[model samples]
Target: MAAIDVVVPNYNYGKYLRTCVESVLNQADVAIRVLIIDNASTDDSRDIAHSLAQDERVELILRESNAGTHASFNEGIDWAQNDYFLLLFSDDFLVPGALKRATDIMEQNSAIAFCYGRDVAVHGDDPVPIMPGRTSPVAFRLHKSRAFIESFCRRAVFQIPGSSVVVRTEVQKRAGHYRTTLPHSDDYEIWLRLAMLGPVAELDAVQVGLRTHDSNRSREFAARQLEHILHTAAAAESFFNHEGGSLEDCGALRRLARQGVVGRAYWSGIAHLLRGDMEAMRLLGFAIRSSPVSAVVPPVSYLMSRPDLAGRISSFFANSARSRHIVF
Candidate 1:
């Protein structure tokens, strides 16, 4: 059985703390230890941590002052002294037997750095849909380092759920601590770093449940789509500049990431346009200015395909070639 250390970082999440901690403790077949770090929460979180610490496997770190999320993340990295490590936020939890599933893949393939799977999310107080237990044979795929990076760099989404990712302790330390500067993209850069180190494993099942309440920071970030686009691009830049130097074709990968950013921004703007989000124009402008040559093509292609789209573009840009000629 692998020894796994789960660091549960809390901040006024007392209500969900017990369930989160319980989920970690109950992960089957692993010798589990929980480090509950209460970041000077005003709620009854400290008391809850103390009560949970009654179990020998649970430990508490109570701070009189509040350190930010990145600090807690780095602290967890420092506290990780087991074969496998996970940073499970107090509001999120591991799916039953998830750790075992991740560990099985990593243990079998020593070169695998981390394993990630899907996470089913629920809004405040809503029940998390239960994931049926898997009775079938699992076909875990081990993705090649460069190949996975190529595939990953083509999309701008946060492809993996944080709660569902389990990493190797030694590699996590080698990849280094989360950057305080890259606040929004800290996970983004780190995941890229981890993938660069070795093969990446992807589990087919939901490995964690992401619960969002009123105070959920992830939702706050998601609401600002423009910021999300900029921060994601920033993450790729930081990764290539700081750590991805040794890869054989680092330059090519970096270019792909840059193009991917514009692609994401363009699509995001169109999505907003379809929803009548007035902010769509702003995002489209950002994408166009970021790379005029590549960015203009997407909108241009859409205008050529549909007269309706041409009219829409003309409404936004009166100087469009199609609308000018159509009137003449």
Candidate 2:
């Protein structure tokens, strides 16, 4: 068996599949097996993936119907047999020599459930450094303790990108596979659970090239994604409660949820303001109440009771506001 099992989950990204596969296959100094799980792509992705799987190191699993990204990821994890696993997305590629570095770290630290490195975000051939200062959390960096893992789940800091992380097969198994209910943030949710299990090692090195295109989920549905994240945060809090976990570090989770709701409300308010609707202003006011600073809600609302202020705030966020790039 190979020393590592790599799972590449592909949807309709046929154009980028070959490069992604080649990058993994091209890695030197690491004994790795590659599994491509295609989610019934309407494009030629499956055919290309199957063609590439002819190599002994590569295998292809073609699904009859399109399972969502999370489902495909879980299927790949279930089929993985190596001591460690890496889930590479169809739109991403492993940087040269990244495999050696990631595998070496995992081998050196038995305690590390996973290790992640940095990434270069690409728009076509132009590369942009994302989360430059913050370390990549997606590639499981080091062996984590169970307490730490649980804490991560509670804190909701699993900002690691799925394509950038490498996980120990055992650690993943122990933590349980991805939760199917979380269609969008499955990777984030899983990493939170993993961090709860142990300490995550962070290597400040670039390991993958993540392609950011117009069709990417984050870009396509920013508002919906934010909403889902907020809902997921709430669900995570409930999960911890059922497990008898304490709420000591819950402040961060609450803050994150508040931020999402606030941002959503602010934007939605702007949309309503543009239409000259008073109900939208009222809804936005209610949303502000759900924020961490909700204590000042009545006073603030009183101060900005004018519909014009609501419209200005909405315009400010929609026009000049930047989304937080924090992975979690």
Candidate 3:
């Protein structure tokens, strides 16, 4: 059996630590080691992690000061000794047979750098897989690097959630670790770089249970609409240059991607307005600053009252378009 190392980087997430560690241990058909790195959490994370470390398969690293999640990601990646590596957040867990499913495809295709699957959102005790009615149960696909890059640029595939992805250990080392500079979009940047080296495979089945709560770190940063917009723009610029795209192509794609950013910011501002938040104007400012043209493009008439409905309508149009990147 191939060996895999799963790294769980946590900060004040002690309450969900046990469930996260247990899920890694439960993965079958693979030799696995779980590394729990706690970043000086204030909660009972230390005691809980220590107890979980008592198991032979798990190792606990206690940090003296909070180094942040990306720092912990680099620490775990440097320490791993397995064939494959997965960085699962403390709040999420793997579904049954997830390791087997990803590993089987990776082993058979040596050129594949990484594999990812869909997620099942868990609100309470029950896990609800978000597979749509038309989704296939046993469908999977492999995309050559160039094709994947083009599709990714056009927003064909949905964002690959970091928790549900497993990358070849050596490929991670060669492609480099997550960027400490990009706090908001490091996962997206890394995925783009990895796709440049080899193919990326996708499993249609849900592999990770993504838990939603008020304390999520992502939510905290996502609310800062300007930061999100800037980071996304930076990632697109960096990826476009790295892929050796022509100047004309880069300009066109960058404009389209930034327009998407502005559309998101506009919708976010509307959401804030609906909730009676004071930051609505600030988000609107960000939208206009990012892309003045895209900011003024009125959304559908029905979207004026419900921002959620606007998102669904926008997504339908995005998926339907093939030749160009659709921004709102």
Candidate 4:
């Protein structure tokens, strides 16, 4: 059996540390090791990590300072001596059969870059359930190398759950480690890079428990939506540059990417408007720049709703849209 190293990067998640570590420890019939990298957590995480390290299967890396999750991932990757790697957050846990299922697929087909599965999102303090379904309904579904990448370009959202993914260590190193610069979109960018290199495998059922809490990056992204929009657009641009094509194809692909960005901004702007957030105007401005004709209608309708601000409408539109046209 190929060794599977599961790195649990934790920061102030001491309460849930045991549940997360035990889940990895309990994964059946695989040569698995758990690395608990506590990022100078102020809570009881260090104590819990020390306890977990007593088990021969578990290793601990207690950082002196919180260098952030990306840094933890890089350090963990360097420490991994296994064939496969999983960067599991301390708050999330794996389903019982996840490791065995992922390992079998990777062992059989060496070409697969990574294998990912859907996760059951557990909100707040809910207990992680024993996922009831076929572990391997079919031999894993193989995604064509660039198929997922092109799909992401056309539709600006990453569907894979980060914790549920098992990546080939060699491929992960070759693709490059997570970019510490992109706090919210590092996983999105790395996944794109991996997809570009080789085919990805998709397990049919849920294999991970994704816990949603206030500290989750998704929540943070929602509060500062413009950042999310910009990060996604930057990732798309990177993909477009790296996946070169003929001039016409490149032009067409660029337009499609822009359309995807504009669509996301359009919908997200409407959501902001419904909530009466002033950021709606900024997002709408982004949309308008990307697709001028389509983006103008929503903002115009919004302005019509607020007759008192009629005088400032034109000026607001002019100034907000003045920034270089970023597709959402």
Candidate 1 residues lying further than 4 Å off, grouped into runs, are 128-132, 135-137, 299-328
Query: In candidate 2, what are the lDDT values of residues 1-328, reduced to their tens digit?
Result: 2388888888888988988898889877778889888888999998898789789989988888987777877787788878888889888888877767776766666777677877777886454343232222234434445544443433333445568788888888877777766665566657766665556776667788888787777656554434554655655654454332544555555454445445445545545555565545654665565654643442243223233555555555566434322111
Instruction: Sort every candidate by TM-score, greatest first.
Output: 1, 4, 3, 2
Where is model 3 poorest over a 10-residue stretch in terms of lDDT?
298-307
lDDT of 1 by residue, 1-328 (tens): 9999999999999999998999899877889999998899999999899999999999989999999988889999999999999999899987777888888888888999898988888789775567666532356878898877776566654567998889999999999999888988899889889888899998888889999878998789887788888998888888888888778889988887777777777766876776567768978888889889755468343233232455655554554433232110
- In terms of lDDT, the poorest run of 10 residues in model 2 is 129-138
lDDT of each: 0.82, 0.65, 0.75, 0.77
Task: For each of the candidates, give the backbone clash count.
Answer: 0, 31, 0, 0
Q: Put down candidate 3 lDDT per residue, 125-195, tens digits, no spaces.
A: 44445333222234678988766665545441236767989999998888777887777787777887887
Which residue pairs collide in model 1, if any? none
Error of 3 at 114 (Å): 1.1
Model 3: lDDT to the true structure: 0.75
Candidate 3 clashing pairs, residues 3+ apart or interchain = none
> Model 4: runs farther than 4 Å from truth?
132-134, 137-139, 239-252, 271-279, 296-328
Superior candidate under TM-score, 2 versus 3: 3
Comparing 1 with 3 on lDDT, the higher-scoring candidate is 1
How much does candidate 3 score in TM-score?
Answer: 0.77
TM-score of each: 0.88, 0.71, 0.77, 0.83
